[model samples]
Target: MGRVAVTGGTGTLGRTAVCALRAAGHDVVVMSRRTAPGLATADLLTGAGVEAAFTGADVVLHLATSRGTADRWQTQTVVDAVRETGGTARVVYTSIVGVDKVPSSYYRTKLRCEDLLHASGLRCAVVRVTQFHEFLGDFFASQRFSPVLLTPDVPVQPVHVRDAAAALVRVVSDDAVGRLPDVAGPQVLDGRTAARAYRDARGWHRPVLPVRLPGRAFRAYGAGHLCSPDAAVVDGVTFSGWLREQLGSAALT
Candidate 1:
């Protein structure tokens, strides 16, 4: 098995992918900016240590991402580093579903990164997935302290992080396929429903107020820009199942 290097290995999705790759008998090296015990140190923001992190890697999983427009710069740095290597290894990337159609700043930057990969000259595969279940929790939990939880009334299909990680592992193990099929959760629910499910699972009685925000981003979200029901390859686990797992784990601690 060839060595696989994963950037952003400390993030939730990254960590899951790292474990999946390792379980599949691949030599996995974690690349991140922070100095973690088993991670290769590299900062995509400043373009530092990227070359060393990618050295001798037969498969580079570009899992690193940034907030807002800064993602463009970070992705550019990685593309530059890969170009310098002159190696023909496969570079698998994780991207959000509907990034090309979504009218959000983060999605736009992700689309730009996808473009960079297409033009980077190296073998690459872009695995686009819907929002993770944990991301939905974070979205609703942002205003937990407030009397009412304000959540957008847009549809969301959240996949489990481990399911997405397994799909990525399949991509890395097979031949490089550009722009693979979209991955999404088995169930599709609006933000309010998702938030309520999460709250109920935690035994929190906080009232969820669904607010309709008027904007291109929210409009796109309402129009189902983030959902690809027809083309999506649904995972087995549902959002409720994921919530139960979270609850079970919390009970142990």
Candidate 2:
């Protein structure tokens, strides 16, 4: 069994990856700022608590979010820590598809992080994935009061979080580097369809108002920047299925 370190180990995907690794009989170490049981605390931004966590680790799964300028610095810090502690460690970075096509600040930061990882001179695997099913809930919360769900005129291929996690696990277990084919949902669904599905599943009375999103970011999304049409390996529960499960559980309460 190999020693694996998972950053953002408390997050949805990270937690799932940790569980999968443990289930496979691998020694798993969770790295995050919050002190959870069996977790190694580390602040990637300042690199204050990473070395000890990385010690003896054979593989590092990087899933932390570097927001703003801190994103670049934290990525560098993590890369450096991996180099200093375990030079031969396999670094697996989870990234978003079409990071270069989108002009959003977050995507830009993700691209920067990818660049840093590539230049770090470590054995690395960069896996890009489409939007997650959880994004629907986040969107609902962000626009709760709106009579209609306003979304960009973009095509989305949303995948389940578990599927994304599994892909990352595979990358960590295999010999791969650079950009792997993007991972996406089984089917491509537009924003309007997704929003309506979300609303109907939750019994929300809001109508889905599809708006043409402006800017380079929106253009990139509309141009299918977040999906991989030719990707061979696809996994995960479908979005509709996941939504139904969530709504069903909520209704039972």
User: Best candidate per TM-score, number?
Assistant: 2
Q: Go through the candidates in order and give each one's C-alpha lDDT.
A: 0.82, 0.80
Candidate 1 TM-score to native: 0.92
lDDT of 1 by residue, 85-175 (tens): 7666688988998898888888988998999888877788998899898888777667667778787898988888888898889888888
Q: List the residue pairs that clash in candidate 2.
A: none
lDDT of 2 by residue, 1-253 (tens): 7899888888888888899888877899899898777889999877878989999998988887757888788778878898888598888888888888888999988998898888888988888888888886688668877777887667888788878877777777777888877788776778777777777777788777888856777788888888876762454566678887777722210
Q: In every candidate, how many clashes are there?
A: 0, 0
